[model samples]
Target: MSDFNSKHEKVAAKLRNEITGTEYEPGDQLPSEKRLCDYFKVSRVTVRHALQTLENERLIYRKQGLGAFVADTTLNSGLVQLTDFSEDMKKAGLKSSSGLISLDKVEPIKEVNEILQLRPDMKLIRIDRIRFANGNPVAFDITWLPPGYGQLLFDEDLTTQTIYDVLEDKYEIPIQGGSYRITAKNADDYIAKHLGIAPESAVLEIDRCSRTTGNKKVYFQKRYYNPSHVSYVLELSRNDNESMSSKDGLPLKEFSPSFAK
Candidate 1:
């Protein structure tokens, strides 16, 4: 059993190297369990454990009975500074890519005007994208930018990169901070089709309005996340007077008095 553990670790190490080195690029399927077992001279259970470790690391992904595949590298920008989907996925160890769904200059609709704090007659550049992690669609993002930002995107490839990175590196827009709103919603038909989920499935909806130190609105976006594939985590403080809840918000535990207090 000890030997088995070591072999599993070895297999996992090699697989990690392959993934990080891009030996297995995003969207590439990994070898089968049987094949890996043969190569590593390990038992089926050992191979499975190795694969599970990789999955936990978010370096690879498994579909029900479909076999394992290299996880699409993504930037985990949420853990760091504010970033665009394209850039965040890249940092999160998934290959970030995007396809422009649409781009148009339109008068601020009521919702857009409210979100951006714009006048009803304000014209904004709206860009919509279907963002992919390892070539699998995972998010639908719609961004509204004020026109004064000056030719915000140089090319549609901006979808494959982080918007904040682009703005900072290419355009020199520095992000200081912003406000965010997160909620849950049933996936609409469009979201279901793009994310390969059932219609009416629960999904995470994030709306953000970000700005630079200069008080210029850098971007306002609404992102739809596939609930099964991602979850939002909040690190909150719990005073003695507060409470804890299950992920679904059912009450769980009441905070107790502090030891020193």
Candidate 2:
């Protein structure tokens, strides 16, 4: 490798470590290239390469002429990526856990029934969990699945693994695709109790449904997040003919299809 390439690699590794260590908070502006050059005593090429490396890793994002900033924890879930909570946490260098509250077979609720298109007489597997990031509770999740799928899940340990892992690896059911909707919700007594947040607090809620490649519904999930600790992001690409743009300083189509939260 060339000397410049080696320097860039070193610089990138340095920044990557700092970002993972939380030296910079999410959305915080990073030092400018000029400043980075002065600090590292490197050339502009090296600094630019380092910034690009971080951007590519999604640890930082650049705004043209404005410089780069630490990327938010908000998951910018790609439309097609089927990622689970543990995988998402691993990428961010954090340990994840699920506090399994309950796993029972019960009559389907209205929401789960409609989302999963389940027959009224069929029972649903109701699993409740508190998802943690770095050992801190981030989301209170309740998921309902079809009996066949849910039964397969009972053999696995939910506390130590994500359902996605159990389904795909154990049952050989891959979560090929999914859709989600994000909306704000008030924390009720139940949510507050599990999430350890104040009742009536504002929380970000996501309703997600996943299916197999064959179009069979796999799971219907309701997740509530403490907005301060967790966030969501969406990345969009413009076609060759269309210019990229945002609405009112916010990105258009504010949805991350994957359950990155």
Candidate 3:
């Protein structure tokens, strides 16, 4: 049993190397099972097993009658690691800062009251800013926090710090987890004006409600990202127990931009 697993693993590793190391470019088909079998001196079953492993990793896709082809894994970014904008820029070796747009106490902006479970009279501290990387605008952030938690936004220098950082580090309100949804949206006039794109252009909207260590819901935001500057990605696994309630199954690519060219 061990040897059987080991045989396919060797084949899977070599194929993975080729797929990722520029040997097989995106959309390029792999050699046929018979060809792979002859090359590796392995059986057809072993080659199929190897191919299955790559399919699971999203490195390749198989067509029923055609063959396996490399998946285009470029221009996509992962949301697997939940990090504040500052840490995200640090990872990419770029300087990150915020340009404040507006900050003030306000009547609950759309859905802010429900997301935070606030009372009808409780005002929300709305902080609006354009997030920058190396001084280039990448995303527009509109965040709402209850007064007790949102106070950090005023305490810290947002020009050099992030709300998430201040909340977790200073206020000790580490975001333990969050619920998020991603959807493609046409850049509304408000979003386009801030992002400096044409009205009705394409944008990625990431809406999230985050909770603290005590499972207290306190943070809510509408983050509009320029897809050309940032793309949202999530790595999924069949083995993962987490499943979205579905009428049928799951999906992401609902619509693609129709380029007029």
Best by TM-score: 2
Clashing pairs in 3: none
Candidates by lDDT, descending order: 2, 3, 1
Candidate 2, residue 20: how far the Cα is off, in Å: 29
lDDT tens digits by residue: candidate 3, 42-131: 877667767866775668889988899998776231224355777667766778888888888888654678778888678899888998
**Candidates' lDDT values, in order?**
0.69, 0.77, 0.74
lDDT of 1 by residue, 205-236 (tens): 88889886457677788888876556654443
Give residue 179's lDDT in candidate 2 (0 to 100). 81
**Global local distance difference test of model 2:** 0.77
TM-score of each: 0.56, 0.62, 0.59
Name the regions of candidate 2 deviating beyond 4 angstroms.
Answer: 1-80, 242-261
- Judging by lDDT against the true structure, name the best candidate: 2
Ranking by TM-score: 2, 3, 1
- Which sections of candidate 3 miss by over 4 Å? 1-79, 238-261
lDDT of 2 by residue, 1-261 (tens): 445556777899998898888698888898989999999898876687677657656688889889999986455422334467787778667788999999999986876887888887788999999999877888899899999888988878899978876765454454656887889999999999999999999999988899874689999999898887866666664433223334323323333322333
